[model samples]
Target: MPDRLAPLTEALLAAAQKAGAEAADAMAADGRAVSVDVRGGALEQAERAEGTEIGLRVLIGRRQACVSASDTSARTIAEMAERAVAMAREAPEDPTVGLADPAEVARIWNLSALDLADPAAEPGAAALEDDARRAEAAALAVRGISQCQAASASYSRQRIFLAASNGFAGGYTRTSRSTSAVAIAGEGLGMERDWAAESRTYQSDLPSPEEIGALAGRRAAERLGARKPKTGAWPVVYDERIASGLIGHLLAAINGASVVRGSSWLRDAMGAQVLPKGLSIFENPHRPRISSSRPFDAEGLATAPRDIVRDGVLKSWTLDLGTARKLGLRSTASATRGPSSPPSPSISNIALTQGDRSREQLLETMGTGLLVTAMIGSSVNPTTGDYSRGASGFWVENGQIAHPVNECTLAGNLRDMLMRITPANDARAHLSHVVPSLLVEGLTLAGE
Candidate 1:
C-alpha cells in the first residue's frame, strides 16, 4: 500500500542525502500476484508471489548511479544509498543526469477520476483455479479443438511511491485481472495453435473465461490445414489484433533516444510525412481505467495528450527529461522506469487514426493477399526501415478468405509501407494502442 511504501522512499531519500549525493530519487514498490493454470481439466500450476522492492538513484555532480534491492530494512537502505553514491563517484559524468527541477514536478493530480485501482476484494486461489478450469473445459468443448494447451487466470495489485530530492513525491496503486486460453486445433504434425486473452483494471470489467476460451478455440480451428501461399508481390492486411505492432515500429523510430543516437530511420523525418495524408497518431495518458494511464511520468512530470503524428506528418518525438534536454526540446513527460532501471522515454496510450471502412471492406479492396492474424520473429532494420517477419493466417482470393496459410515471410520498407496503409474502423477501443486492421499494398511475400 502507498501508506507503507511512502516511508521507505522517504527513508531512502534521507539516506541518499546523508551519503553526500547532490541530488537523488527513490522508488519503493510493493506488489503481490496470484495465478492459476489449468490443463486437461485439472490444476497444473498455482503460484503466489508477494514482495517489496526499493530503488535509489543518486547524483554526485553530473554523474549518477542506480541501485535496487528486495530488502527494505534501515541497514539495507543505508547501504544502498552509500553504494549508489560510491558508484556515482566513479562513473562517467553526463550533464543531463540530475533530477527534475523542483518547479517542473507535478504538484496537482486527480487520482480518483483516473480510477486506476479496483476496490474489489482480491480473488481467492480457489476462484482463480475455477476460472482456469472452466476456460480449459470451454476450449476442449469446441469440435475441432484437439487440446486446450493452457488456460490461466491471474490477479495482481501493486503500489508504488516515488520521492526525489527535488521535492517531488507521489504514489499510486494499480490492479489487474486477466483470463486467457491457448488452443490447438489438430494433432501432432498437423497442429495449429492460437490464443485469446483479456485483462482489465477492474475484475468486473474482465470478460468471462468461457468467452475467452471459446474465442481461442475458434481462432485455432480456423487455422487448420494451413499451407504456404504463392510467393509474389501482393497486398497484406494486418488484422486488428496485431496491427498495433506496425504502428509500434513507427513509435520506436521516432523515439527521442533513437533520434539522439542518429540510429533511427526517422531521424531525418521530423515534420515530414510518415503516414498517408489524412492519417495521424495521438497519445493520451489520462484515459480513465486504462492500464497505461498515469497522472505523472517516472520523473514526476505531468502527462497530457499530444500528437506524435498529425495529418501524416511526423510531429513530435516521445521524450523524457534527459532526452528532451539533449535535443533542446521540451519534455513530453513520457518517462517510464522500474526498479533497478533508469527512466527512459515510453509512450503511454496511443491511437492511430481509424478509417471509415470495415475490415471486410479493406479485404475486398485488397482483392487477394495474405490476411496476417499472427506474426513471428522479426528482422527490422532500425536504421534502414527494412522490415521482415514470419507470418501465418488466412490466404485471401477474390476479396474473400480462401484457405489458411503458414510459414511465410512478409517483407517491406516500413517507410514505404506506412505511407501506403489503409486503416479499417474496427480498432478495439479498450486497448492502450488503438490501431485498426491495416491494408498495405505491394509487399514481397516469400512462400510457396
Candidate 2:
C-alpha cells in the first residue's frame, strides 16, 4: 500500500511545483471497509466500500489552499494542484501557515514497533452477517429482553502516506474490527434501551458476539422501570463508560485553537491549579496498537509523551506547528488532519490518573447520590465553564444502588467540579481516553 500511495503523493507534489507554488505537501489514503447489520434474526444491511483519495496543499508565501479528489488520474491531479495554487494566490496570508523545518521533521520512526495493522485476512460478508445474527440471537435469548433492536459487525483497513517538499515522506497502515448489539427491555411506553460494543486493532482480540450481546441484554434489563430521582444538591458519580466526557471537556478547554480565539475557560489558567492536588492528565502518542497512537504528526514532526496537567497544575496546551508558532511555544506534535483540510491541534491518547478505590467503594463514599451512566443534550458555556446535561442511571442510597433513574439534569461549573472529583480505578485500559469513573460532590440535580 505504501508503494501504491507513494506515487500518487509524488505526482501531487510534482504538479504543485509545476503549478507555480512556492511549497507544497501531499497526502494520499487508500481504505476498504465491510459492515453487516442484523435485525429480527435476518440480514438487514450489508455494505462494502473501497476508495483511494488524494489531497494537495499548495503554499504561495503565507497563503495556502488545499484541494482533494477521489479520482487519481494524472489530469485530475494536475487540475487539483493548479486549482489549489490559484486559490492560494487569492487567499488571505497568515504568517503561521507553512510546513515544518527540515531539521524539525521526523526522519525515522518505528512503524514495526507500532504494530498498527493486523495480519489476518479480511472477514467476508457472510461471516460478518453471521456474527451480527448471532449477537442479535444472544440478545433476544435474555429472559426479559423484549427485542433486539440491532446488531452489527464491521472491519476496516486504511493506509495513508504523507509527503512534502520539505523533504519529509512517511506512511503507515491500520486495521480495526468491531462487534456491537442494542437491546430493549419492555414494550411501548415502558421500553428502555441499552447497548454494548467493543473494537480492537486485531480481530482476535475482539470479544465474542454472544458476550457482547448478553451484556447489552443485561444492561437493558437493569434499566426497566426507571424513574426520576429526588431533586436536590447531591453528589454524582459518572460511570466509567461516560466519565471520559468529563475529562474531554477539560481537554477542549485547553485546546490551542479555543485559547487563540479567546473562547476557552482555561485560557488564563496556564500553570494554575485546575484539578485536585494528586491528579494529572498525561498524553502518550506511542503506545503500541492503540488506534490513536501515531509515530509522526500531520506536520511530519515526531510525537512523544507529555503531561497536560501535572499534580493538578495546567502544564501544557495542545499545539500544532501553527498554533505553537502563534503562541511562541514549541510544537507538541499534536497536529491532526484529514485529506481535505490543513492540520489542527488535537490530542491523541490521554490517561487521567487513576485512584486507589473501586467504583463501588467510591459510591459507598458518596452514600446517597445519582450514579450517572448516560447523558443527553449538553449546555456548556466554554467561556464560563458552566456545565449542564440531561442524565439517566441508577440512584444510590446507603452506599448501594437503590433503583434505576431517568430524566434528570446535573448542573455545575466545570472548574469547581474538576477540583472536587474523586476518581475510581475502573477505567478500561484499551481505550484512547483512559479516564476512570469520577465522583463529583455537591452538584445541583433537577428531578422529580
Candidate 3:
C-alpha cells in the first residue's frame, strides 16, 4: 500500500516545488468499508466502498492553500499542486502559517505498540448481514418491544500516509468494527425509541449482537410510561452512558481555536479549579487497541500522554501547530486533519477521575432528585458558561427511582456545574472518553 501512496505524495510535493511553492506537505489515504443494515429481520441495505484520495498543501511565503482529489493519476496530482500553489499566491499572508521545523519533526514511531489495526481477515458481507439480522431478531423477541427500527453492522479500514518537505514522512493503518440496534416500544403518542451500540478496533473485542439488541430493547421499554417531573431546583444525576457530553463541553471550551477566538467560557480559567478538588481529566493517546491511539499527529509530531486538568486545576489547552503559534506557545502535538483540510487541534483518549462510590451509592446520596438517562437539544452559551438542554430520565424519591420522567429542561451554568460534580465509579475504560455518571447539585429543572 505504501508503494502506491508514497508515489502520489512524492509526486504532489515535487509538483508543488515545480509550481514555485516555498514549502509543501502532502497526505494520502487508501481506504475501504463494508456496512450492512437489517430491518424486520431482513437485510435492508448492504454497502461496500474502496478508494484512494490525495491532498496537497502548498505554502507561498506566509500564505497556504489546501486542495484534494480522489483521482491519483499523475495528471491530477500535478493539477492539484498547481491549483493549490496558485490559490496560495492569491491568499492573504498569515505569519503563523508554515511547516514544522526539521528538528521538531517526529523521525521515528512504534505503530505495533498502538495496535490500531486488526490482523484478522475482513469479515465477509454475508457475515455482517447475519450479525445485523441477529440483532434485529433479538430486539423483536423482547417482551415489550413493538419493533426493531434498525440494526447495523459495519467494518472499515484506512491506511494514511503523510509527507512534507520539512523532513517528516510517516504512515499508519486503523480498523474498526461496530454493531448497533434501535428498538421501539408503545404506540401512537406514547411511543419511545432507544438504541445501543458498541465499536472496537479489533473485531474480537466487539460485544455479541444479541446483547446489544437486548439492551436497546430494555431501554426503550423502560421509557414507555415516562412523564415530566415537578418544576423546581434539584440535584441531577447524569447516567454513565450520557455523562460524557458534560466532559465534552469542557474539552471544547479549552480547545485552542475557541480560546484563541476568546469565545470559550473557560478562556480565563487557566490554572483555576474546574472540577472538584479531587477530580482530574487526563489524556492517553498511545493506549493499545483504542480507536484514537496514534503514533504521531497529522503534522508528523510525536504524540504523548498529557494532562488537560490536574487535581481539579486547568492545566493546558489542546493545540495544533497553527493555534500554538498563534498563542505564542509550542505545539502540543494535538493536530488532526482530513484529506481536504489543514491541521487543527483535536483530542484523543480522555479519562476523568472516578469516585469511590458506585452509581447506586450516588443515587442514595441524592435522596430526591432527577436521574437523567437521555438528553436532546441544547442552549449552551459558550461565552458565559450558561447551559440549558432538553432532558429525559427517572425521578428519585427517598433514595429510590420512583418513575421515568421526560420532556423536561435542565438549566445551570457550566462553571458552577463542574465545580460541584461528584463522579460515580462506573466509567467504561474502552471508550474514547471514559467519564462516569456525574451528580451535580442545585440545578433548576423545568417540568410539569
Q: Which one is best on lDDT?
A: 2
lDDT (10s digit) by residue, model 2, range 1-448? 4489999999999999999999999999999999999999888999999999998999999999999999999999999999999999999999999999999999988987888899999999999999999899889999789999999999999999999999999999999999999999998888999999999998998999999999999999999999999999999999999999999999999989998889999999999999999999999988888899899999999999999999999999999989898899989999988888999999999999999999999999999999999999999999999999999999999999999999999999999999999999999998999999999999999999
Model 2 spans with C-alpha error above 4 angstroms: none
Query: Compared to the true structure, candidate 1 yields what TM-score?
Result: 0.99
**Local accuracy of candidate 3 as per-residue lDDT tens digits, 34-81:** 999999877899999999989999999999999999998888988998
* Model 3 bad stretches (over 4 Å): none
State the C-alpha lDDT per candidate: 0.94, 0.95, 0.93
- Candidates in order, TM-scores: namely 0.99, 0.99, 0.99
Error of 1 at 252 (Å): 0.7
Q: Which RMSD values do the candidates have, in order?
A: 0.8, 0.8, 0.9
Clash statistics: count for each candidate: 0, 0, 0
Kindly list the per-residue Cα lDDT of model 1 for residues 69-147, writing each as its tens digit.
Answer: 9999999999999999999999998887778889999999999988999999999999999999888888888889999
lDDT at 66, model 2: 94
lDDT of 1: 0.94
